[model samples]
Target: MVRKKLYRSKKKLGQAPGSVVYTGERPKEKLFLEAFDFTKDTYTEKQLTNIEDCFEYKHTETVTWINLNGLNHVNAIETLGKHFDIHHLALEDIVNISHRPKLDDHDSYLFLVLKMLYYNNSHNLVSEQVSFILGKNYVFSFQEAEGDVFNPIRDRIKNAKGRIRSMASDYLLYTLIDAIVDHYFNVIEVLGDKIEDLETDVFTNKSSDNLSIRIQDLKREILRVRRAVFPLREVISKIVKNETNLIQNQTSTYFKDIYDHLTQITENIELHREIIGGLMSMYLTSISNKMNEVMKVLTIMASIFIPLTFIAGVYGMNFKYMPELEFKYGYFAIWGLMVIVFLVLLFYFKRKKWL
Candidate 1:
């Protein structure tokens, strides 16, 4: 039920463009850096204690993947950007986590922003902005937190199980992007499950007091997922059609595969939107129908009692000169007549299926 705010801080409101401002909340955990340098014949992985420790990997002939966990540290981001010759604007976008998925192609490198999505321990969807700087021999990745969906890619690199060790840095970039896009399927599947549960509750009349609230929450979640995912289509499209040296010709094919995945993901997102809309309408309709049935039963009971009340009211009238009052069988005959009337009405109602 939490709606994420756009700007966590106003520190960058009046600041100039290309200003490196960390707009997100500061984490208690310190900044962490992990470096993976690998080639066809050799592979090495290290956990660096300081940002300066990773500066040497820039000049290495082998492909390097430098991942930084904490974005709340502005000094470390500025220093890293300065050391790598990354554009000031790119660094600004990196610190601004609210920025959507996009691509900035430079002559020397390509800067890309993407949303990494996954479910947390509580099964709530969590999104983190992941920015990547793809250079000739190194790929620099900046993230908001530590855990991500790239563990499979990491295992592949560590075990040297695939062509990742043999491919160039461009192919490595493709693999990284592919990993993120693959996790989108998992998120979308969770959305589909939610839609099914909503449908079940609506159809089976098993709705709870908070059913509507849950539906609204699901709607907001869909919006979040869409916001995180939809724009990536353009980002991938740019990479596929990009003419930069950072993205090689062979790797363009692999990026196209990512494009296809995005297309499928967007289609599923739209489908989920429609289904959620239908569920809201169905829930409302079910509630309305339930009320109508209750009203119908009450109306039928009132119809059956009106005539009986009229008979009782007529006989209860005071009349001292009334001849029926003097007759001995008058009370019994009146009782018989009332019972007949009641039976006849009951039979008629049963024939009409009013009961």
Candidate 2:
């Protein structure tokens, strides 16, 4: 069983606040930066390996989205941090991917840290830390790795399929968060299917030796997901409640929609956890019942054989002057008597429902 681990904050224990440190995973993939600039009537996209390419849109009123795929490159993060004038603490949080789901509100922008969930090819649940800085006319999205669960939002921007192109930076932020939250549904669906298989294995006559391990793994994953999603409600409500001016009134409703989805995800996770717990209890109970049935059968056989064993012992005794042993019909008589005794005991036991 995998237990939930406490985020060890020891790395920053003696360090000063705003000190930048990479706290979570260390990836080997090279960093890739993608910039999307769009408006109600215009759209532009670029893929640049250099951070300097994004500097031109730093002060522009045209909504620009900068997505950096890897966080292992600390120098690259510092360059963008300098350009945007992002606070040292925000930069620190960006690099320290272990930071939980939280929102840090500043006057010019809102900094948010989120957990992006995805499933690998093996259907194992994977979590990546994604941080966002929502500025007046620009937003910076920092991710821990190259591939992401944001293809829907990318497709939307590429195809002009939705109102996202016409929306402001805050709406774009909400839309992107919604995209990440929507990925949870796929994880849940895949896990739900696995749970169905586990249910059969658990309830079937043939027990799987690996059932316990799979249950523990699933439970641990569910708990991890719940931990990531529960705090997201507060993160979105901070926006909906307008704690930061970066989120406009019109865009607040969209955040509320995201909050609703987070709520549904949380409820589903909790329900699954309950079912898994019930399955555990049922497994134990089923084993107990099986043992009891076996014991009852053994006990019944012993009861039926006790008197017969006594009669056999009485006749098998070594004695030379026993009167019954000398009689010619003694063997037949004893056999008839033993048969009568067995039938009478059988009848009594059957009547008492113990047969």
Candidate 3:
């Protein structure tokens, strides 16, 4: 029997902020705040401790990006929400952790939620939720954990080599979303390599219990990837279609580019799924062919032995008047005849190609 290694565990769905359950000494969730303040030639970054301190930096002419790592601090989130005039529901969804990938326009702000994925050491798929609130001057991001897959974007911003950081918050949001989508390509590429390796092994070697388990795991991972990416297409489409002042017209082109990448990733995922399905069919066919060969060999051996066994049984019957028993050479002649019969049957089977 195969064992399942990855599954979702049950947990409290909705808990109120400040409830003992929320404050109970769960490991202190790391909250990393990285600020990128940039305008054409000038770029500055700071690690902020409190969201309130960000209010001064919000209205600056320079585009500012405030990235908040952990959302466990309800007080900080509420303060940030109030400072930015973010809607209550958006704040609620920001910390919900289970919110689906989506985009919403709040007139003054654009709220976006996306799922970030990575393969762990065990080759199991893992995902985290990322929430973004884009306003006129500043952009705020909330993640479930501290570390991000966005380190490259940070490096680009720091080097001041790219227009990404100097661009408006909308462009920063685009870069961030683009970076996440790019990681999908990396993940799916790894999955494609795995499928290729498994295909080679399936054809060259017999299928084992592990093969089925690995196929199922790959299928599940692809499904998970699809779930994460499919909704993003709609999210980006909405950004492109809706004429939001928050997302500049020029930046809309970048969002369209992201949409294209999402489409490519979706196609790649579909192809991978088809390949896995083919591998599964091959596995079944191989098992059936092996079983058929075993049955054929067994039938041929049984056919040759049945008549020989009957002949021996007849000679073994006890009878005082048996003529063959009275002849001295009869025993030797019987053995010689049996040998001839066995040789003829073997020759016939060989000629028929049944051997």
The number of the candidate with the highest lDDT is 1
Per-candidate clashes come to 0, 0, 0
Models 1 onward score TM values of: 0.91, 0.88, 0.88
lDDT of 3 by residue, 57-146 (tens): 767898888888777777788888888788877887777665569998899889999999887778767777889989887888888677
Model 1 earns a TM-score of 0.91
Candidate 3 CA-lDDT value = 0.81
Rank ordering of all candidates by lDDT, starting from the highest: 1, 2, 3
Q: Is candidate 1 or candidate 3 better by TM-score?
A: 1
Models sorted by TM-score, best on top: 1, 2, 3
Best by TM-score: 1
Encode model 1's per-residue lDDT on 36-97: one tens digit a residue: 99999899999999989989988889999999999988789899989989899999999898
lDDT of 2 by residue, 1-355 (tens): 1122233366667889988776655657688999999987888999986988989997887899999987888788988889888999899999886778999888988899999998988777888889999999998999877788778888888888889988899988988898899998888887788788888878884566777788888998898788789998999988889888888898998888898998898889988999899888887788788899899879877877788888888888998888999999999988887788788888887898975
**What clash pairs does model 3 have?**
none
Model 2's alpha-carbon lDDT is: 0.85
